[model samples]
Target chain A: MEVKKERSNNICTLYVDGVLDYSTMEPFVEKVRSIEEGIEKVIVDFTDLEFIDSTGIGAIINLVHEANTKQFEVELCGIIDEIKDLFETIGVFQIMEALQEESD
Target chain B: MCSREFINEQPREINKTLEREIKLARNIQMKLLNGKQPYLENGEVLGVSIPARVIGGDYYDFYVLPDGKLRIVIGDVMGKGIPAAMLMILTRGAFRSAAESTHGPGETLTAMNNAMYNDLRTLGSFVTVFCADWDPKNNTLTYANAGHNIPLTVTSEEDIAEFPKTKGVMIGGLPDQEYSEESLELDDRGFVLFYTDGIVEAQNKDGEMYRMERLCDVLLKSYQSNVKDIKESIVQSLNIFTEGVPQRDDITMVLLKSR
Candidate 1:
């Protein structure tokens, strides 16, 4: 799994690529978790994530909860339709924004 | 004049016909679970085991011997579809192959795990399996649960008792992990069910689940262990639960009953 970070102005963006499964999720989780201290807004881009197992889904859910605790609004951008459906089915959309495109 | 030639031709034709028939039978047998009944052994009942494609990714096929012994298997592949089916068939072949020598539940799981780990993981896949040797003659069901969903044994009161996961990893992940072994009683007329997460994770229009708790509730309601009724109730509830909802995932389950 690959996680790339970009910061512009106040918004912090993360690009997640590759499979987010138990084996690969370890490092992915650490990268997302590390940004909790500084970012005011966390935008995750899933345009690159190929597959995600339950554990990976759990990590996303954990990130959502973490963002809530940290009071940072998290928005997901550039999600492919298939992975979007996965998050929707698991009720992740209810907690975070599932963006098809980014206007900014 | 034609007798010698006609007689010689009959044997070859018969051999070819036999080969064709065997091939046909194999094709029919492969579809043993072609979206039909006799396949749905368990109705809306408690603790159902829906064995998918007798040779698919999920396999749990068991029967009793004339001397009154029960055998059970629950295996999941590291991949889905045809490749999983091939591995399942290989396991079946190995079962019949080492049936005499492969008697213990623990040993069977270990043997299967070792053979597949290197090759299956090579394809970025691994299987979590639970193979059991249920000796009805002694009312004992010994099994080893791989990295699969924990099997739940329910009672007439809608209470659930989870069986332990013994010596098993995701079957092919680590070479040195120890697989634990455990056993349980089958004295009563209750049923033990096995299934893939597909069944429980299946969602309806509202995103509600045909979860384990709800499934157990259905089984407890019938209080009758007839495989047909129980299977029907579960499927019926599933249909109701997922009303107007397309299948989100492949739902597979299997059930075992003792008389």
Candidate 2:
């Protein structure tokens, strides 16, 4: 997977492209966790993301936990329908919702 | 000073030893995962896991609870290869222990998460588990999920598919995770299929995914077959769909059908 970062006024948006499977999860996790310290809000854009599997889903959940621990506001943007259905099916959306509420 | 021949033989010997150890590990994994099938009074439950490698991260198990209910669980640990296989064993231990003390599937998952969450966090990994209890007397199947895919239920009388709803995060995703339980009555000759993501996500040479729609179609066609036959059908369909494309992930499934 390829990650591109855009920042403005303490808000950082990360655009992800390509498939996020087992091989790409490590670097993806590292990149998500490496968001700049000054950022107050984090957004993950999945418009260009083609595919993701269970391990990839786990990495996203891990990112949510990290967002919780680090007290950063996080939002998932431009998720493809299939991946969104997957996240919904496996209840990842619930975790995101719950953690986001906690942060709020 | 070691001779050249001796040095050459050392690497070969180490390769032999490594191959032997991997074979041993594969044997252990097979024995544990392919243990005895559980029989319900009027129902049958069968489970199988096919690793992409000699061993894989996919897991499924059945436990005959003291009260006569069958406790079933299927899980996929993060990643693949040897480390994933090791964690699959760890997941098995946690499931077995939790199934004993926990009252229901939800409780079992909660206990499992409580037991393994810290270790998973430390290792930067996680697992998705779906647990169920089949009560033959009541003809009710109660289940809970920890971020695993929802199993599809196909009835012989109807062509439609049903996905039992569940709500929970993956094991180790949160420190303290609570799972919710849902139950449904099992109809005779109907099939309840629990599977890992591998089957649905299996890709063909054309880069086309097998997809859930195709799986549903296959299940609808095979709903009348015996449990073993249904499993065979799934594997056959997957093989045809992939058509020489190598497997990318471990495939596992447990099919429960009432006679």
Candidate 3:
């Protein structure tokens, strides 16, 4: 998975791309945790991510858990429907805010 | 479930018609196991689920053995879908007969595994099985896990006991595999719960697992309640847990209570 970081004003943005599976969980979480302390709300863009397996799903879980414990608001935006469905099934959308529109 | 019906009309192509019916049957297939077994009274519930799918990959049968043993069997076929289901059916027959004749949980699984392995391997299929009996009289249970989930026992003592450890290859993976028995002596009024990996692997909305820790918490919480109630509570908790996250895996669990 590829994560791009952008900061403007008070918002920190992450643009994620590629497969997010078991092998990619550590890097994925570390990247988010690394910058979490400096940000108010972390917005992750999943528009470019293709597939996610079990471990990848676990990483996402870790992200939310960390975000909650650390008291930082996290939102996922620009996600494709396939990945979105995966997110929906796990019920992550209920707890985490979704960025409703595509950012193309 | 949005169901479309073509009522009062025979299908055009029988082959296509049969296929459609099978798919529909699968979608609507649900188990309503409402009866007392072993320690349970008139309204007690004891059940086990082994999917013929990724989560339900086995032809599961829960019935009374001729000698009055509370028999439960869960066996997964080598692969997924219809072919595996067919193989599960075959594997199931051998199990029931052996369970009846030999009357040993370990033997039943071993025999079925051996009998079906070559044929299953030929078809590129394998089966993982767990079979057992609940003895309410002594407040005890005996089981054999053949490459299946370790069944957990919630005793009246409330000391949670997992099915004992045994080293055995998954069915269909090896031609000659030996399985050993694991026994649990229950406190009065206890039950055994078994399930597929699907439950632990399920995810919540945050992409976190509705993992083993969470599932164990539920089991511990609901041990004293009725099986159906426990199942309902679990499903509800899972639904709420994911909030709006979609199900990535099938969910199945079987609870057998010993009074």
What Cα-based lDDT does every candidate model obtain? 0.61, 0.87, 0.62
The TM-score values for the models, in the order shown, are 0.59, 0.92, 0.60
lDDT ranking, best first: 2, 3, 1
RMSD of each: 13.5, 3.2, 14.7
Q: What docking grade does candidate 2 earn? A: medium
Each model's DockQ score: 0.04, 0.62, 0.02
Q: What's the CA error at residue B146 for candidate 3, in Å?
A: 0.8
Between prediction 1 and prediction 2, the one with superior DockQ is 2
Q: Number of backbone collisions per candidate, in order?
A: 23, 0, 26
Off by over 4 Å in 1: A1-104, B1-56, B63-68, B94-99, B176-178
In the range B35-146, model 1's lDDT, one tens digit per residue, is: 2322212222223333333224555555343444545666555444455656656655544443345556676666666666676545545565666666655556787765
Model 3, runs deviating above 4 Å:
A1-104, B1-19, B24-43, B48-56, B156-159, B244-246
Q: Where is model 3 chain A poorest over a 10-residue stretch in terms of lDDT?
A: A95-104
Q: Which stretches of candidate 2 lie over 4 Å from their true place?
A: B1-12
Ranking by DockQ: 2, 1, 3
Residue A10 Cα positional deviation in candidate 3, in Å, after optimal superposition: 56
- The 10-residue segment with the lowest total lDDT in model 2 chain A: A25-34
lDDT of 1 by residue, A45-85 (tens): 88888767555665665676566667777787888886675
